[model samples]
Target: MRLRFLAFLLLASGFGLSSASQEDSPRIGDPYFHSSGAWGQDFRDQWAFDAIGLSDPYVVWDALGESPSPVIVAVIDTGIDWNHLDLSWGSLWTNDNEIIGNGIDDDGNGYVDDRIGWDFLAGTNQPWDYDGHGTFTSGLIAAEVNNGIGMTGLNPYARIMVLKAVNNFGRTRTAYVTDAIRYAVDNGARVINLSLGGPSALELETAALDYAAQNDVLVVVAAGNEGQDLADYAFVNHPAVITVAAIGRNGERSTYSNWGPQVSIAAPGEDILSLRARATDTLMNITDAYKPGSAIVGPDKRYYRATGTSFAAPFVTGGASLLWSRNPSLTANQVRQALLQSAKDIGASGVDQFTGHGALDIGAAFAADPNASIVAEISSVHVVQSTDGPAAEIIGTATSDRLEIYRVEIGQGETPSSWKPVAQGRSSVTNAALATVSASEFAGASVWTIRLIVNRTGGTSQVTLYRLSLG
Candidate 1:
């Protein structure tokens, strides 16, 4: 089954289909069948949720009182169903300053009257989810949770900012996507989800991504569904973006998920059924829907089954938004590092081509203390080394005007027991500062560690280890 899916993806790419066709596009249909219960067994299994274990790390949930609200995440895809029940909670903000029917640039952001979001394809603000692809993607990221209907998104409280770059016909141009990205960054979008990709790389897209990085916006892109190495394509080679691969229930790489050093992490994308449009012009439940046997005849009289890494990419994007919203001070690079570091290692001891750092562990990420201090202050230390070797510098600051003393030591390991004193420093004023001995003291192959011991001499004075630099 996986091999056939990969083959299909390869063929789709050859024909210029980015990932999968738009949900509204005409395609194969499944025979109408009725299920006796709620969709699939996987839907009711709490253990299945446990298997994914997607919970926030950094303890942002507890600190923020509620999940981050009104955090804008731009879904740079086809378009979103503005009326989708699951997505109504955190819908895009309309620019009230601009008249919907007027042909004026109210906000003056280049696009005219982009009340909700700009449609680069149509060159308008009416970015409706015509093809249903963006709606599904948005649902994965910020679909309303605990709404007593449909599925819960990773960050249900996050706002879904729609930036339509692809058209209803599943045709997208590189220039459109690039413009969408720039608009997303300029419009206060903290995260940008890119589920569409092609075999060709564009210089404009690269510049747009670079601009996003410079502005501290996190860009989450699919690692492609071709089951091939992304290193072979320059389009997915952006280091500032988090490239997501797809993983199956068995904790293995999805057969259609591309693999390579460029792949940053994996998410559950196999047999996952997200919200899809029914033939009757209503929503349908298609959980655990995979290819071949996973098709369903919607009320609209169309066959639909959700599959591909395209769906998985939004999960990461939504997760990132939740994390960023909770901690607005965190830079985009820091958020990417945190997500990658928190992933559960699957394929190897370190990062691998297939899974990168492994599947995302949201639960672990939410449970861990992101701001917990790992460094402590003592005194400055010095060691002997060659003149050309790397130098070590440690600086200290006094927190109060009263005298503040500190003890310093050099250690062979991370623990204090492995440490030995080499130098010491003391401060008598609040503005006092100190630095470790010169680089000539510690050189060669010896691995030395520095520690600082702070003491209050007068009043309630405090001390800090300000700087630590090693060349």
Candidate 2:
């Protein structure tokens, strides 16, 4: 009986139909479905959530208070399944100026009846998912949380603005994407996630990116999966775009992810479980050879497990929306700074080529203060004779809008690329003991650079430099 069922499913897949009925899919009452041994493998699914520090978002929810304003995020890819069980209709961005199903260009933006969003592929208003990439990414960005049915999204306060530009075969030209970027920016989308890209760096696409940046919209793109260095990929390296890389369950760079100097951050992208679009078998068809029977995650066949930088990009997109939802006053640059500065550093200290700043840490991002500025100056530095041998006492006055901690670091030479922390203080000080650096550390150096950094609640910091003569 099982062999016969598998054969029938394979036949259905060949005909471009869903292997299982959508109505009979898993729900809350099916106690065994999500936790069942066949589907879940117990915590193996949804491991990305914990990896990004979203294991329990209630603390963030509590910090955000009752209801934060919704941030609109544009998903420019294959269309999304808006009616998916886990996706909320209320969370979708609606165009108040346009009348739905009117067959008229009510708002005069060119596309007629673009109530929710426009589909450049089908040239229609109903931009429903047929290729499944958009649906998968949308679910990652704004799937309803605590609904007791499927996995929770990173941001519950985001309104997804679906803009379908890619076709059913996951192929898209630069023109379609450029048009979609303009539409998203004009339609009040604060963040745009581009999970599709090719090698070409067309002028049209760069112009659209500039338009978005000029309009104060944050655009996030995925580093290609070619596994080759993308140091010269102009599209992903654009100043206006935030290029993201992929990390696996172990928090290391995914074997297939491309890396380069342009990568701003990394996020979970391996074995990711998200919504499976109806009548679409992109994952099943692609992974049939290497990993069979693993594409379809649940008995209900409503979830999928796939891996790519495409999936990793949405986690940052979702994080951007959540940050905007909490602060609502952060500029596109500020949001980008907070995300990068607050990342959990991995692979290399400070910043590196592979992971950029590091893996996404949404919890720390929520606590970041990108707008905070420091007014500080180093007063003086003097030699102090101590029993421990030659120590330098540094004095400084530093203050910030939201000062939480301050650090003093010493490095060899008058201009050092890196500095070592010598002392740290929690409170604001006025010409007080900012740091006490031991001369023994840099025994051979005659001149040293001392840095005083004022850190805020978030990972953002402001620095003041001073050169000291240690002769």
What are the per-residue Cα lDDT tens digits for candidate 1 across 1-471? 000111012111011111222221122121111121132332221112333463222234454455455678898876766766555634565566677778888778787878788788778788876666677677666655555444445564577777888776555777788778888898888888888776655467689899999999989888877777675453466767888888766788877788765677888775444455322111121122223323332233222235577767877887777777677777787677667767787864335567776788766555544532111222233343436454454533322223355555555432324545655545432222344455654444255445554454432222122222344
Query: How many clashing residue pairs appear in each of the predictions shown?
Result: 26, 1
lDDT of 2 by residue, 249-296 (tens): 778887677876567789988767688888787654343453444466
Q: Candidate 1, after superposition: displacement of residue 254 in Å?
A: 1.0
- Report RMSD for candidate 1: 12.4
Task: List pairs with backbone clashes in candidate 2.
Answer: 368-458
Q: How close is candidate 1 to the true structure, as a TM-score?
A: 0.65
Cα-based lDDT for every prediction: 0.58, 0.74
